[model samples]
Target: MGLDPQSRVLIVDDFELMRTMLKRALGAFGFTNFTEAADSNVADQLMVEATVTRRPFSLVFLDWNLPGSTGYDLLCKWRGNPRLAELAIIMVTSESDREKVQAALKAGANDYICKPISIDKLKEKLEAVGLGKVRSA
Candidate 1:
């Protein structure tokens, strides 16, 4: 299903600037709801809370390297959990190695985007994950 503008998005990154940039980019793409977490612990907490509240996030932009835990670890954890098995995740990181990309995908990430993300690339990845922009009527 295509993502609605109102879809909830979670951005898990250690850099505040990156999170802000992502939020701005996603906003331009028509998404209105966003939550940012600086590390994996907070991201996991937020995800669980959202799920428990019955308002699970529609998408998650996860950084591969975090302060405490890696995004790959989190992705594996979530993928193993049935409650989060269906959550759409995109790895947003600077790691562009072929093996790393393959590993993330194998771990259940819907897509992967390298750092210095361009608007067009971001749009393409979003669309690939069924989160394409929703045009206003």
Candidate 2:
């Protein structure tokens, strides 16, 4: 099934521009709801809030480098947490290193995207993760 247009997605990045970019990219794919975090701290708080509100985020586009903990660190924590274990997390980073990719996968990232990301590539990753292909309007 295609990703729901109302799916609550979270964008976690230290850079405001990157968050904006990802949000815009997702918007093109029919996503309409979003939450953004500038660091791991904010991400954690937001996740908790979402859980309490019973509107948990369905997807997360996470940056590898952040002010506090790294995306890998957050992924590992989430994977270990019962409430967040099922969250679909995509590591969005500039790192193209094979080892880093492997580490993120091991840490439990649902997917990974390199920096300077293209809409097509992002769509492909989403589809690969069963978010469904973006249908052209």
Candidate 3:
């Protein structure tokens, strides 16, 4: 289903159920190496504290809504940094705002997907972000 175990991915969502859902969906999509953070603050901390020992998340499925800041804000924060410039981020949220999508792309989101994501669509999204072969259903 996936390419390797060392391909770390991060899911950032403030809501517990949403995070759980994403984790489950990604697992179903054959991504075992994954982690989660509740909000942007925690996500930032996780990125900052990361060392060379552990691989930085190559793929990030970020939630558009968060407690302290919107996902758009987080994208700006992450994208502003040179270290995370090449990171591939996919904004996964319920909000279908076109303006938000435009901003995220400008701010460095590689792609955007709305919530209630299906397994096949998620796999395709991942493939677009540079991952395993995406099988059509």
User: Which runs of model 1 end up more than 4 angstroms from their true locations?
Assistant: 132-137
Tens digits of per-residue lDDT for model 3 on 52-132? 445677778889988898788888888888887667899988888889888888888999998788877788787877765
Let me know the TM-score candidate 3 reaches against the reference structure: 0.86
Off by over 4 Å in 2: none
lDDT of 1 by residue, 1-137 (tens): 56676889999999999999999888887887999999999999999999999998989999999988899999999999898866889998897999999999999999999999888888888888885554432
Question: What alpha-carbon RMSD in Å does predicted model 3 have with respect to the real structure?
Answer: 2.8
The ten-residue window of minimal lDDT in model 1 covers 128-137
lDDT of 3: 0.78
Ranking by lDDT: 1, 2, 3
Provide C-alpha RMSD values for all models, in order. 1.9, 1.5, 2.8
Superposed by TM-score, candidate 3 places the C-alpha of residue 80 at a distance from the truth, in angstroms, of 1.2
Inter-residue clash pairs, candidate 3: none
- Model 3: which ten-residue window has the lowest total lDDT? 1-10
* Residue 85 Cα positional deviation in candidate 1, in Å, after optimal superposition: 2.6
